[model samples]
Each structure stands twice: as structure tokens, then as C-alpha cells.
Target: MEELWGRRVLLTKQFSAVLDAYQTFPAMIDQGAYMRCTRCNTELLKTAILLPSGFYYCPSCIQMGRIDSSLQLIHQAEPANQTREVFLDWQGTLTPAQEEISIALCHSLAQKKPHLIHAVTGAGKTEILFEAIYRALKKGGRVALASPRVDVCLELYPRLQEVFPKETIALLYGGNEQKYTYTSLVICTTHQLLHFYHAFDFLIVDEVDSFPFQGDKKLAYAVSQATKEDSCLTYLTATPPQALLKEIQASFIISQLPARFHRRPLPEPEFIWWNHWAAHSKKGTHLGKLYQLIDQLSQKNHVLLFCPSIHLMDCLFQHVQKHFPDLQVEKVHADDDQRKEKVTKMRQHHYQLFLCTTILERGVTFENVSVIILGANHPVFTKATLVQISGRVDRKGAYNFGRVCFLYDEQTVAMKLALKEIKLNNQLARKRGLVDEL
Candidate 1:
């Protein structure tokens, strides 16, 4: 029955073990001409959705499970658990800038106001969030930190576990094998929030600009529905999207952390002309420049080679393996079955060169890494994405500098914009005296 708390699930025989314990509600609400999905709130015309069996189903959330007119959704009101007297176990200290943002976050939570933290890539956003999270938990309030990317959630879970070791934190995401547990703290992807309704008193959306949360209406709806009426909602992003900016203009309290905790300048990308590189890569010929760059960078730092597409990345990965057999290199994309293991291997310095798609552009960090994009002009490489990919380098305080190269046939607007943004951030850090002279 604890597993049923705060969750809205379809009334299936699988849940018969707890079905009698909670009241059930209709899965779809009918309005004369249309029916709305109780989970996703997607509306469909009754005439367009009528089934031969006289049952209307919500196709919008069918991936979760078929919620048809015949089914019911059951949930238990979120209960305030008896929290430990002290939950935070971290011994690290926040920088002055981070401490200021942390205070602002706590104030927002106390006021139950929506807030946004527009911080730079390595600005210690998580550290800034700790105080607020602790305050909420101390009050026995349910808290959830959601992101759009599964990689981000995976990266954040262990860190949260380390900081709040005494608390039972549930990590939820699609394809996750971990069984659900009722707890005060939850780290999950935005999609998982669809299973919850008014569950959180303190909710945060990290990497708010990253897809599929960005420009995703259903995900936004889920975030809204998951929070209690008087709950505090916070958004954290290095790159602020137009939607967030507009919200700040309207009412949200905004905190801007322009410099990283390391107090170092952001690395600007160096554009190198590699004409006809794609054809050469596909044919496995005339890659001397690319080979030379990888060889030199790999000598001192790990190499992150970003390809524009999976097909191209796979082709290049084979070529790289053939050319540098002794160098431990691995390729990962969205659908790689061994993605998690491969990334872990890279983190342990087992892999010298990692070839990947933009799936790794944000949320994960690597120290002393040099970034090289195969096709900087590709449509898929947006300015925000390029910034995030470049940010993966030199993230730790020990390694405060690294290289970023944009290898392209022709530079695109996105490439130019990414460079401009990095430079602008550096200038801001200098103006604010947040970084020392190099």
C-alpha cells in the first residue's frame, strides 16, 4: 500500500493486491463532444475516438498503458512521513555566489513562489539546491527533482543519495528496473510525473531547456499537475529558453549565477575548416587532420568526438577503432544497449576517446576532456546544444582549462552563436570579478 501513495495508476488486475484500499476515478472525463485523458489531459473528439467495442481510449498516454473508458485510475493521497532529525550528510561548502543563490531558493520555497536559476554550466546549481531540499524534507514535505533526460536523472541520483543518505529517495525513469518506493525525495524524468497528481510540495525542473521537456506541452502539464496548489516550483538551466524568460518577465523570481564555482572562464570553441570531411569519414580516407587532432588531444586529455548523426557516428567509430586499436575507444548513442556501462567505463578513464551523438550534450561532466564536433554545421547541433557539449570539458576545479574544436566544412549560425555565448559569459564573469585574470 505504500507503493500506491502519490501514484495514479490504471485499475488493472495487476494492482488487485491494493485495489480495494483506495477509491477509483474515471480514467477519462467526458465533456459533451470530447473526452480528456485523466493522466495527460489530452482531449480527443468522441466521434474520432469511438472504439468498435464502444470504449474510448487515450492514445496520447497509451504508451504508459491503455487508459480506456472502461478503466479507472486509483491513487492515495501523499502522506507526510516521519523524517529523520537530520538528513543532509554532505561536508562540502558552497561558494559565496552559490550561497546567495541557495538563500534565494530557500526564500522562494518559503514563499511558495515559482523561481528560476539561470546559472552557467559549472555554477554548482546542485549545491545551491541542497539547502532548499533539506528545509523541505525537514518539514516532512514531499520533494521531487525532475529532468527531461534520463542521463541527467542517472547522474543526479547518486549525488542526491550521497548528500541525503538517511532519506529514502526513489529514482524513477522509463526502463528503470528499480522498484517504486514511497519516499520524501524523488529524482525522476518529467514523463514519470504523469503517474503523480499533487504529490510534491517542493518541485524542481532541472535542465529546463533540454528536450523533450523543452517545447513539450504535455510535459509542462505533467509538472504543473504533480505539484500541490501552494507548492514551490523551481527551474534550473544554464541556457534559458524563451518560455522561462517570459515567465521571469511575468512573475518568477530569477537568480543569475554567471560564473562557475571554479572561478574560471568558459572555454570558447575553435573552428577548424575540414572540407569534404564527411565523405572522407564515410570512405575511411583523408582523415589525417582529424587523426592528428585526436592523437594530440588524447595524449593529455580524454577526447569526446561528437558526430551529427548515429549513422555517421557508427561509421566513424569503426574507422577510429581500426586506426587506433590500442586506444580504448567506445561509441554510444540514444539506443545503445550498453550505454550506461560504456559511460561508466569512460568516467573511470578506461576509454581514451568516446564517440557519441548529442545525447551526451548536457547533464554529464568529464574532467580534462577536449571536445570535437564532426559536423558543426549540422541542423541537429543547435546553439544551446553546442554550448552544453563544449561545457562537458574542464568542468572540475582541478582542471580549469580545456579545448573545444568545431570541425566543419562550413561554419553555421549555431556554431557562431555558441561561440558568442561562451565569450559573453566569460566577459560577464570578468566584469563581475568572479574570475581571476588568466
Candidate 2:
């Protein structure tokens, strides 16, 4: 339009639309007034040149140098429509076998189908995401790849950046910023979706059944509202939830890869009850079986002892450190600011013994990890948590000698279910020849 007040001005539908939105918002910045393009929710930068017609046009999308202030383009240009094939490393780069399955999964997701690939931990699930994302990007669409933990996103982002160098893929987390111009692909924590509204063309939810994301309907609704109704939604996880199973129809696609890189079997976890024995000593306690494991591993390598709480972790740390004074013992948890540095120290072998809560149970990979779950019988241990904890060891190679000790006072329901679930996964992997004869 020629004038903001009134005018015998001519305007195209798009400029009229941009103008319509601009009028509704007050010029005051702190008045809680901001204008976002309804189509993309793209906020016009305040530095943008305001036309006489009072339309704020992003130079990136539209340009009006002079003459009519109605955004009659000096030289009309199309919105960015460049789409390039990109790879996404969900785990890392893929091998020939992994590449095959990745290709299949990509096709399935692009077709708006549901498929399950029960790949083991360290099966390179992150690298496998590349093909799927590439297919969607080449189809001229935006993709949302989300995970329940910021830990997973931290690992998933850099690899995606390497594969999709041309596409803008911003990593979104609670404390992170949106630093890209217009992201065609996004790696984000599930919580970050709360601020989105119809912002993507494809949505991929990783670790779908893991924690916080599964329980929050607002996050789920955020995913739904952040995409067009016809957008493809891809779900990835080692284990599936009851709700996901119920949502399945024939249109869903399923794939399975049950082996690690070296093809060694998933570890066998043993249960030992030292409750009766340890209970006899009111001073402190030790499960003979777990103690034996600690002694054996300490002779050769470091050990990761996981407990249910901070108090339990400290108690174990003290108890273990007393007997092995020559050894270094360190711990990490939510309350510690040195948590990351502690983990780094452990990785560098600064300490031969480490006690940790569930925080270190993921994202970080250890080559020679021997996991011992104290109080495995406690109700705090769930199938998913146990599975994640167990995933820490023997990332590659033959049957790892590390022992997984589930030492408990009693075998609670959580213990039984976690054991059963792990064994079931092993059996599934074994059938696929994912494990050695052992």
C-alpha cells in the first residue's frame, strides 16, 4: 500500500498479507509485541527497513529498495527452494551392512511408513540417521530429529553438520540458541519443541520411550503442531513403547539390525544376592560376588559402579576406595559442576575406579567398561534404565570379559524385568547371528 493510514495503493496478495500482520502488532518492542510471518513464523528483524506502507520485509526473502514502499520487489526473487541430498550420522559413519539398512529406513520414512530396526547399542544408530535425513531433504522438506536427552543431541549434532554441510541444521536445546538463518534440518532436545508451531516438514523422534518425553503430552503436541498434517514422522528406539505398538497400522515399516560393529554378543548379566551375607554386618556391606568382580577387574582395568542414589554412590565410593588405596576413585552427578571434567578424567585413566549415578549411563562411551549395578533390586532400576546402563561396555570386538554384576539384597520386580528384557534382546540378536557362538 502507498500509505500506512490509507491509500489509493496497489498491492499483491503476499505484500498485503505481510502488511496485514504488521498492522496488528504495536511498534513498541517491550510491549510484548512482535510480528512473525504466519506461513513460517519467521520474525522480521527489527533492523529491517520499514516501507512507507509499514511492512517489515526480510531482505533475505523480499527486497524493496525504493519507489513504492508496498514491497513491490525491485527485482522479485523466489524464497529459498534449494534442496540437497544430505547424510545424517545418528551413530557415526555406516558400514556396508549398516548402509543397506539405513537406505531401507530412509525410503520407509520418506513414504510416511513405520519401520522398526532393533539395532543393538553401538550398532551405530547415530550414523544410520544420515540416509533418512538425506532422502527428506532431497524431497525439498524440513526435518526435525529430536531426542529425549541433551546428551544424545550433543553427540548427534556434529556428525549431522559434517554430512549435511550445505543445509542449515541447527541444534536446539533448552540453553542453546537458534544461530542459523533458516534451518532445513534441526537436531534438538524434545523440550525445545514447546516453542515451535508448524515449523517442519518431517519429524524424527529418537529414543521415543525414554523418560521425560514419553510422559509429557505437551512435548508430543509440540511435535504434532510443529509439522504440516502430511509431514512424515520417524520414530527410533532400541525398545518400543506400548503406545507406539498400539498406533501401528499396515502403513508402518519395520526393519531390524541386532548386532554391534564387531558382531560380539550382547553381554550376559549375572545376578548375585549378597543381601543375607551383607545384612549380617551392620557396619557396611558388600555382595561377595560383586566384590569378586571388582577385585578381578581392578587387577587389569578400571570399573564403573552404578548406584541408585548419591548417598549410595558415596557409600560405595568410600567402601571401595578404602580397600584399594593405591587406586583413584572419582564420582559425577547432577550436583557436581566438575561432572564433565570428572568423566574426562576417567576416560583419560586418571582414576582406576569411578562411581556414578545414571547421568554417565549414556552419551559417553568407554572401551573397557565393566558395569556393576549396586542395588539392582531397587525399584529405581527400570528396563530402559538397565538397558542404557548395560550399553556402556565392549563397544567393539570379541566376547568382552567384563562382567555385569546385578548385586542386590532382593530380586525386585524391576531386576527380574530388566534381566528378562536384556536376555530377550540378546536372544533376538543371537538369531540374527549378531553374537558369537559363546
Q: What is the C-alpha lDDT of each candidate?
A: 0.88, 0.64
In candidate 1, which residue pairs clash? none
Q: How many clashing residue pairs are found in candidate 2?
A: 16
Query: Which lDDT tens digits does candidate 2 get at residues 1-438?
Result: 212211111234646555533333221222124444321223555445455557554332222112222323211111233666565433456666588788888776666665655566677776776777677788777778888787678767766787776666678775554543346777888766643544566677887877777766656765665666566677777767667766664556666666776667667678866765334222356445556777887775578888788876766666766767887888878668786578768877787778888876666667676788877766677777777788777775444476677777777776777677778767877776666655
Q: What global local distance difference test value does model 2 have?
A: 0.64
Report the lDDT tens digits of candidate 1 across residue range 1-438.
Answer: 777777888877777777667868899999889999888999899998898999898888776767888888988877754655756888999988899889999999999999999998988899899999999999878999999999899999999999998888899998988888888899999999999988899999999999899987778899998998889999999999775697566788899888889887888899999999889888899999999999988988989999988988888889999999999889999899999998878887788999999999999977778899998888999999999988887788476347899999988898999999899988988998888755
